[model samples]
Target: MKRTPFGAWPCSIARAVDLLGDWWTPLVLREAVFGVRRFEEFQRHLGIGRNVLAQRLNRLVDEGLMDRVPYQDRPLRHEYVLTDKGRDFFPVLAAIIAWGDTWLSDDEGAPVVLRHRTCGHETRAVVACAECGDPLRIEDMEALAGPGLRTAGTAGTARTAGTAEGEPTAAAADSP
Candidate 1:
């Protein structure tokens, strides 16, 4: 569960994958975000085993992406709701939907459309800079080492920029 270093090649992808990469995890989050709060509801919608659904929900709560609320007094039934961090994943889910609509849709149009309540218009997910309102592309961003950086020599040759084979760049100190 340890996080790999930033600025490392594929580090962002790896961290994201580590956090919510599994086949069931995103679906669980999808259900939670979409208001499928009850355990039975998730089980029915996903057709996942009760035990697997239980584990995914527990993991989300442990990770602080979800809050468990009491739904029934007797025997304490509960429903899971998204935390702020979980809500922040809306863009990620939208992107996933976009990707599916592009590559997996049977028809040219999307299977399910997301409409803005205020505008009454269907919208697509966009990645944009908050300050500039500029759309972000892969090449528009740069990843820098954060508070986790360590000296390249001491950390590993994985950080040597000119390392002969299978080495990480100098900018990527903690990449292994």
Candidate 2:
């Protein structure tokens, strides 16, 4: 069997792992999205070492996913704030939570359910067809390479066409 270097693959998922791929990274993002912004907060919440937390925060800031803001002047204290790029990850987090709840949870349902403010009911994250409002299925998609995707293959190409472009293509329409 042929083997490929894990990092050598030109895929978005692989690239994402290279950047935010640490086992601790997603937990850090999870805390950040849930309003834990301070270095101390992250350390406390995740029980991560101060050094590791600092490194992750610095990396996130360098990637433009987070920004450091001074919250206290006397001690030169700062807090991390999510940038638009970081804020945009809410859907990704929601999908992850939904999956874990479905597949990993015991008899309990989702640990925390999302309730839409407009409608008084629980909501599951849905990516639907804009034109016909139909729910999207894994088969209902394709991927077309962009500049970033020039080198990515299977892993880099998880961005489904219908989801990325918000329109069903001929291939998507062919799904039974």
Candidate 3:
């Protein structure tokens, strides 16, 4: 089935979703973040078919998330290394992991524990107010319009998570 392209959407989230494509892309990225660089390694870890893995890697490379570097001089083999943009995606992944650990963990609890290299302590990701460093809570916030808000198209008032189009965004000055 043909998929709608969201890269042109005014919302950054939509554009990111379009670029990430599907489960394979993020899984591939997860591996890349964990230092899995080569094609064969990604395949082994993900259990994704060769063609599909190739496709996802190529898309990531095309999207500037990963760089294909020549790793072997003899066979011209390459490894997929995360670019700066890709490395920057860690927070987003960390947020996802945090959410999963909170709501989706089974009887054994979270499968992974993230540790800070500098502090040498295990920690979970936290989404907080960047300006004041307060943890974000839905009740403590309000939605506000943004410059990209499709103008009369919308600067919607919904402070809800991306449940619908035109969800709210908070500005530094925004107060509930």
Candidate 4:
């Protein structure tokens, strides 16, 4: 069956999910973030199928998140390195790790912990406002209508869920 492409969705969350929703992609990214630059190292650490790993690496390179740089000239071996775009994704992975550590960890506790290099202290991931440095919470946020919202025949206005006449708001999914 063909998967629905959420990349074209109007929502940023949907677009992000479309790109990073796959099981292996995030793990591959995690490996990269951990400084796995060579193909052999990634394969050895992940134990992923060669073809699948190749595909993920290629996609990441094509997306400008990684650069495929030739490291050896004799056999033309190339190593993957994260671009600025790829490095920026580390925060997202940290947030995921934090959530898993909180809600899904075993009794042994989190398999890993993040320690700040500068402060020399363990820290938990938290999404904060760029300008204010305050933690972002759902209750303290509002989703305003953006320029990308479809508004051809209607006046430009933000509509809360259940407030839009004749429009249906999505019901919560039973499982994540």
Candidate 5:
């Protein structure tokens, strides 16, 4: 069966998953953040097949997360570098690391520890509210209809005909 296209979803998380949901994609990004730039380095670090690694690298470049930069003159060698968007993915990786260390680590403890550069203290990633700067808990948040949510009859079904720009439509407001 054909899979649903997550890019078409109105949710931001769904769209992000559409782009970065694949297993190898995140691994590749992890290596990139750790300073693995050359094809051989990524292949060696990941132990992934050459064709799959090449495909993932190409996809990352095509998706604007990485840029291929020429490093050698004679053989036309290139290295992958993270773009601004790719750099922005570090927090996501940090959060994953924090979760893994907390729940998956052995009794000896986490394999790696992150230290803050300025204060020289260990740090862990946490999800916090942008406005209040308070750490967020899953149980404390509620999902609410946003303005970008697609309203009925606009593309799929017949319902309310008009919704003001930036206003949640009646159909969306009524949806659980």
Candidate 6:
């Protein structure tokens, strides 16, 4: 079946999900963040099929989240390195890890713990308001219309009406 593209959606979340929502992409990114640079290494770490690994790497490169750098001249082998945009995605991965460790871990506890090298302390990721430096909780947050928002009959609105249930309403999905 053909996949419905979400890249052009007005919602930043939707666009991000479009790029990274697949099961393998985030794992590949996690490996990259953990210093897995080579194709063989990613495959071995992920236990993913070679073809799928290649596809995910290519997609990440195309999306500007990763840079494919030539490492070997003889056979032209390349290494995948995270770009600035990809590095910026680290917090998202941290949040995912935090959630998993909290909700899904066994009684033995989280298999991994993130420690800060500079502070020499273990840390957990938390979302905070940029302006106030206060932790942001879902109940404390409110959505407001932004500059890129569009109403019905407005020009440059890319989304169509009648999206499936559980999807963001058009008015709530403002372009970024």
lDDT of 2 by residue, 1-176 (tens): 76344556556677567777678888899899889988888999999998888899998999888999999999899999999989987887888888888898888667878777798898777778889999878666656666655644433433454354666566655689
Tens digit of per-residue lDDT, candidate 6, span 1-176: 98788887766898999999899999999999999999999999999999999999999999999999999999899999999999999999999999999999999999889998999999989999999999987545555545555652235533334555567655567645
Comparing 1 and 6 on TM-score, the stronger one: 6
Candidate 5 lDDT by residue in tens digits, 58-151: 9899999999999999989999999999999999999999999989999999888889999999999999999999998754454555556755
Please write out the lDDT profile of model 1 over residues 1-176, one tens digit for every residue: 97554434334575667778679999999888788999999999999999989999998898889999998999989999999988988889999898898889986678889998899999888879999999876534544454333434224222232354565444555445
Better of 1 and 3 by TM-score: 3
Ranking by TM-score: 4, 6, 3, 5, 1, 2
- For candidate 3, write residues 73-103 as lDDT tens digits: 9978999899999999999899889999999
Q: What's the C-alpha lDDT at position 133 in model 4?
A: 100
TM-score (C-alpha, index-matched) for candidate 2: 0.74
Better of 2 and 6 by lDDT: 6
For model 5, what is the error of residue 69's alpha carbon versus the real structure, in angstroms, after optimal superposition? 0.8
**Runs in model 6 with CA error above 4 Å?**
151-176
Model 1 lDDT vs. the true structure?
A: 0.79
After superposition, candidate 2 runs with Cα above 4 Å error: 1-10, 130-132, 147-176
Q: How many clashing pairs does model 4 include?
A: 0
State the C-alpha lDDT per candidate.
0.79, 0.80, 0.85, 0.84, 0.87, 0.87
Ranking 3 against 6 by lDDT, winner: 6
